[model samples]
Target: MVRGKTQMRRIENATSRQVTFSKRRNGLLKKAFELSVLCDAQVALIVFSPRGKLYKFASSSMQETIQRYRNHRKDVHNTLREQHLQQLKQEAIELMKKIELLEASKRKLLGEDLGSCTCEELQQIQQQLEQSLKRIRERKIQVFKEQIDQLKEKEKSLAAENEMLCEIREKIGQQARQESNEDREMVALTESSENSDVETELFIGPPEGRIKRTLTSLYI
Candidate 1:
């Protein structure tokens, strides 16, 4: 019968866990010692028990070995940091070169620094200028059309306002003419009333005066 592999898990029993720790600690210490003796290599091992007990084995001074490890890690980290810095410097140089080329191209487009341009380069610049001018003219035409539309809208608004004002003026004139006719009719009625208000007094005057006036009229 084949023996089954034991599962590599924590032992739950306290006695079994202590026994396993003791066996493993002795085996590990023996291995470290043999390796150091046979190969003449520095070795360091540290183990902590569940009860906070310390166990250690070292071929050389433990503090010296740990310091050496720390120094080696620091040196490796510094080397990596220097390599990253150099890569960033190279990328910055490349970016600066690109920026300079763009600036030179911009200057050339603005009719500056033309002493080194080839015939083909000049032709390319001319084509770029022509394309730019074409776009600018198109934009100008679009702006002019927008302005004209705006002006037409403003003119329509003014015309509508003028028509409204003319209607108001005509109404005002008609009202004034009606008022004038009413005033003239009132004045005529008042004058006719004054003419009909004559006082006729028929008095019994002296008969001699009447007779004398009658005789004077007959003689005439």
Candidate 2:
């Protein structure tokens, strides 16, 4: 092939294009075979024709040659990937150092450990720390307000339960009092002589010597 002599244009004639494809394909396959034999190297070449037919050549079995090529490419990619990972690791270390410096500066600003800083530096640090603290305090207040709301809700629920229990206790107490009064009345009626002494003018009886409710009260 002539070096840099061809114009950058397609061969429009179908027959010329087909002829060129065949000749170039043969030359490429010849070059691959020569490289394999002369350099004691494995080689593989694959070409797809315009009609979608495959054309191929290899110094040995196509599978073995292709496998060798793939392995060679994989080794190169692995080396590059390792180099990239090492670069990333170095960058990560740098980032960590920066973070440590920033944290130390922040601690100094907060008036935490000022043994190493000058008075002026401490003042600047304090100013920055005050701003940060103000932000944090605002956030804390917001959280506290939310908690207070939650507590209020819980108090409302508990109050409702307490009111219900109080009502139930009052009803039970009233029922017990009514039962006790009934029991007392029955006991006095059974005595037969006591009611006449206490309320003789207001009381009446069915007959003398008649008693009522001698048995204990039944739930039914």
RMSD of each: 10.2, 12.9
TM-score of 1: 0.56
Off by over 4 Å in 1: 1-11, 130-220
Question: Model-by-model lDDT, in order?
Answer: 0.95, 0.86
Writing each residue's lDDT as its tens digit, candidate 2 over 29-129 gives 89998999999887788999989999988878998877877898999999999999999999999999999999998787656778988889877877887
Of the candidates shown, which would achieve the greatest lDDT relative to the real structure?
Answer: 1
Instruction: Supply every candidate's count of residue pairs whose N, Cα or C atoms clash at under 3 angstroms.
Output: 0, 0
lDDT of 1 by residue, 7-38 (tens): 89999999999999999999999999999999
Error of 1 at 170 (Å): 20
The segments of candidate 2 whose C-alpha lies over 4 angstroms from its true place after superposition are 1-4, 118-220
